[model samples]
Target: MLDIAKLARQMPEIGQQMQKDAQASVKRLEMAQQLFFQANEHQDNLIKAQELWCDRLIFSPGTPVESLDTAIDIPEAPPSHSVFSSDGSQIAPSHHEIIYCYLINIGRIMLHYGQNLHPLLDSIPEIYYKTEDLYGSRKWGIRTEEWMGYQRTLKEIQILTEMACTWVNPPGAHFNVPNLAMTDGSLAFWFLDTLPTEAREEILNPVIESWEQLRESKIPIVGYISASRSTEAISFLRLMACPYDVPNCNNYCSLDNEKNPCQKVEPLRDSSLWQKILQPRQRSAIFRSNSRILDFYPESQKTHFCYLHGGAEVARIEFPQWIAEDSELLNQALSITLTQIDKGFGYPVALAEAHNLAVVKGGDRTQFFSLIEDQMLRYGVRNVGVSYKEARKRGSIA
Candidate 1:
């Protein structure tokens, strides 16, 4: 009567279907966004109030911005005054309107790492390296040629800085709100060995040299933000990149992007929240009357599990009993926490291995504790620990 094998055989297919469904959902959202914005011809204050940092150019596919000598698209735009069309329709440029380069499309977010000679130093350092075991997990290292990744990141920084230099900071620059270099990666440091020595000096010399001047003069600020997998990393880097040292403070856009796809973040504690508050945006998708689409719970959401492995470079804290709790309030909290850990769940956060709270027993509590501890260490987690004795006293079983 046992059908274990039969059930096992169907899981892969089931997983594949779920993946397709998730992807489909993403596509649908993208489409809806386009339709909503375009329906009003970029008006209506729904989507195009302000240019999105990386929303798929909802208005038009990017075209080569013609010559910089003639690059100021809105010459009519006053330096600080809001320029209006002859028809009086508002046509505000993106806040990031660097005169020389416009962000054509936002590429995927990438993590940057660094080394204090520790892969997952139990204690976080003040800086990260692009190759220093991203997120303190071996699995997270870029698979491409280390040199190539180095070159690519370097190039990205250079291009961005150049954009700032010519377009954002150029003489007669339009609006000035401090030049913020929002990157998920490390801002100041890079892996030199991965790059040819000549390329290293050539590419980084400008950034280093120019940044030093900015650091000294205190007129324009360059900030480094590292909100990668580690909150400690963020704190640590923020300290290292002191406002004077690197004043900009990795303040990326706050108005709810995919990293924080949910707009109505309860408690709204993430660093990004402060960013949204500080740099308020209206007539843009980042802020609106209805709030971000993230607040509305959608049906057909998929749940994923991360098999908790102990002592891993990145470890998550979860219990084998949350799902089993009988308390109404406790159960709700448990479900929310567990769903947050789902690899497929919205937003990125620390993760742990999956434990079927439904099936685990009080007897297996010791093993569970051991598992959690080991997984945590392996993943560079030093925050929480599993207490088998506590579990046992509470009659916890495997």
Candidate 2:
């Protein structure tokens, strides 16, 4: 339980810290706004900023960045189109539960949009409890919640890939209609960055394979991130603030714990950078992600992103380079995304439905454990017991 009184006692200190932070943030915002208007003047600075961090591999330079002040109109949607989106939820391995099993539910939706909406497909939940499913004994020594979440993400991508393949090569009639495939978050697999090289490969191999299949199937795939705080693009502005040349800055920026000279834009986020430029129903220019993890993905599958402003906050939408390079494909993707947002009254309805189908509520988790206990008893296993704390909580009266 939380110590509310103790937390209350610290409120004064917390408030002071918050005020300091807010002041620093205000300074950063002022710097960003100044750069926003003078973006054309600092075009070369953005490029040099990327070059300075090029070796570090944390920055991906955006193209036509001189057009940062401009906003592109929302693209037109195809008359008839199909949209597929996938989302997943998982029940992490629990110590309090009788069984050591964990569950993952992946929800998929295929919606056809034209004159009116039509649900062409539904959600499918797949639960795995076998020893092989619970643990990654081959690579990981222990089963962890992080590993489970990674597996859940892999399944989500795999399902989206499978659906993309199926839709493109329908058993009877090919899906000639413009179709798009999307997942709920960033396409980059940043979660594996700290894992051992071999473990990262083991976890990402299937995901990469699925992505290859999806790309080969020619179905545009994108990852939708709402309220993104990514600063990849804004980091470019820091280069403009650098007092030295790009090469000199590179020399000064080293892995040997040298302080970066261009830390003036410390608190700026990408959405904030574009918020000053983009209007509702408009999108910013696409910029390729220079994430170090992109090295794991094939060159063709490198992710790129752009900021889109709906009636609400700026959203970052990531897609493979192939989709971004082709104008028609990019427009179709943008159109479908806007349509989804409109349908859901600000977000994608398909993803919303997929999340709804995949979410595992607290009550559902309780019933799941109860079912496990019942099955164990039915199998003549009587030693199963809940911890004392769990029992107390179960029996506690308000």
Candidate 3:
């Protein structure tokens, strides 16, 4: 376990001890690093590393895909007849089918899945697909309903938790049947494509196996990640470690991504790990900073960069690389939601977002700051203070 106390104390002295090295590590926080791919032999072996943990290795059929054959017989029927939308427009937003319950805290967050007429300040509505009469009365023990006006969307709530548990929990992280991997989207595929064969075998294969099994069985995956930011890492660990809080200790986003824009890929730069991978110019183009790389290339977007074996091939011939524009899509949101308060030196800013998962993609990690500012402006409420427990005690069913 990472000792937050030690990290906090040691952080101040790092620059003095190791100036250049510390600066380089800090520079990595910028999202413009290149993805490292292993040699052919290493690549082949990485695919084989899952002999122990998992039964077999495979990619999940996320979006429907029909692959081309060697013989190239009359091409199979396409997954979608046309890439355009109903209105015949080319651009179609890939609806976020999965929900990752990233920052759920029993103390900070109040989750109400089943019907219980209570609307705490932090209350979330879980919409149920079925009606109350069918099971609310007959199967009261399992499916009791209490007109949860605040939590009218049970299915949505359940799925969000499932997605959260899937990404954070590692394979075999919990004895209970686990949510192994995330929805293997284009970003993941692109990340996989850039991995070195050695790293792929050692670190990624087990993860890939976890994804494949979940896909085959329709089981949700626990997408595990560790925090890139120190503050976030501590907060996440604290919430998850508490027995009464976010169950399933899913450590998300601490792994080394060759193409991670946030981290400067210096150690492996020009190393054998990046042999025939993306070109240097293309590397700069794709490994951009402060852009939502996932949105840039989405499975729901186009056949942009989602090509793999037995899938729609997006090889180097068609689309050379994945590039992120200098677009701060959330800038407007952040400007409206964040607030400044008195603190030492300058001031501290508090950011928060209401419980929402449907349209809010990529967890509420970045949105909270944007949201807090917006809520304060509305209703002339600078800040309506409410604790987690206080919200649950509210009498309103909302």
Candidate 4:
């Protein structure tokens, strides 16, 4: 427990420092806003700079697909539409546990508006304990926890894709309404960038296949990030502010020197920029992600994103290149997202419900381990025990 008296003694100093930081932040925001307009005015030059320095830049700058300064008003919501979302939670394999195993629980939700269709909510739990499942391929060298995270994301998208497919072609009948499929985070396979070609293919192949299925079904899918601190847009603005004609950061810019022209609008995020630019329910222009992992993705699956002012905060919404290029589909997706946020009170209802279902609480973890131990005992293997470190954590100590 914290000592209130000790904390109170330091509160004055902390408060003073916080005030100073707040003032500095305000100054940065003003300069950032100015730089933002300047970047917009010189948008063509900035785009040219990106083209020239594409291979040399250290940061991932977004490539604008539309006018850089434009903010489109939210499109009218459809009278009847469906939104499907899936989220997942995992109990990563732990060495301190009685058994080396993990559990993945996926929560899926489907909500139809103006159609009188009953909403669907379900959760699926799966366990991985086999040697092949736990360790994965020896060549990959990825930790079990990290591998499980990737697998969980894949399962979420796969399940969401399956849900959309079923809705699109349900039992000899075709239901045609504006449908949107959403996941909780980025769709990019960025984590696979460090892995070998074989490992990347092993992971990305299925994800791309799922994306293709959604595309074939003509269902628009998106990855929604709430209160995002991503700086891809800010990085683009920084590039626009670069003094070098060629803008070669490796040769020209130095982090040790605080005099870099691009550092003028330092310590700002994409969301902070959008919060100043976008009105409620409006969305910024779409920008293509420059993540290196996209080199492995097909043209159709390349990731694109835009910032949306969804009432409470700026949100980063990402989708595939195909969806971004299709104006009608993009508008439908934006409409669904804004409407859902309004209904859910600043968050999407489908995603909120899915998260509620996916979360594994403290009690759930305890019960999970107890069940494993119970099964081991049932098999007459009574030697099952947690690691000493885990046992100490559970017991009281003076």
Q: What does candidate 1's lDDT look like per residue over 1-398, in tens digits?
A: 57899999999999999898777655644443333333334232222222332142111111111210111111111112110000000111122211111111112221112212211101100112334323222243333333334444454444433433443346675544222222223332424434444645555566455444322322222111223231221221122222232222225323345432221112222132222212211101111111121122121111111111111112221111111122232223223322322322432222111111112344543443455457668888765532555436456553
Measured with C-alpha atoms, the lDDT of residue 69 in candidate 2 is: 66
lDDT of each: 0.28, 0.77, 0.25, 0.89
| Regions of model 3 farther than 4 Å from truth | 1-12, 17-38, 45-398
Candidate 4 per-residue lDDT over residues 49-119, each given as its tens digit = 89987877767789888888889998878889999999999898899999999999999999998998898
- Point out the worst 10-residue segment of candidate 1 by lDDT: 81-90
lDDT of 2 by residue, 184-272 (tens): 89998877777788778877999889888877777888899998878877765655666665534435655454346666666578887
Q: Considering summed lDDT, which 10 consecutive residues are worst modelled in model 3?
A: 82-91
Query: Each prediction's Cα RMSD?
Result: 26.2, 3.3, 21.6, 1.8
User: Model 3 Cα displacement at 105 (Å)?
Assistant: 11
In model 4, how large is the Cα lDDT of residue 256?
Answer: 76
Best by lDDT: 4
Enumerate residue pairs that collide in model 4.
Answer: none
lDDT of 3: 0.25
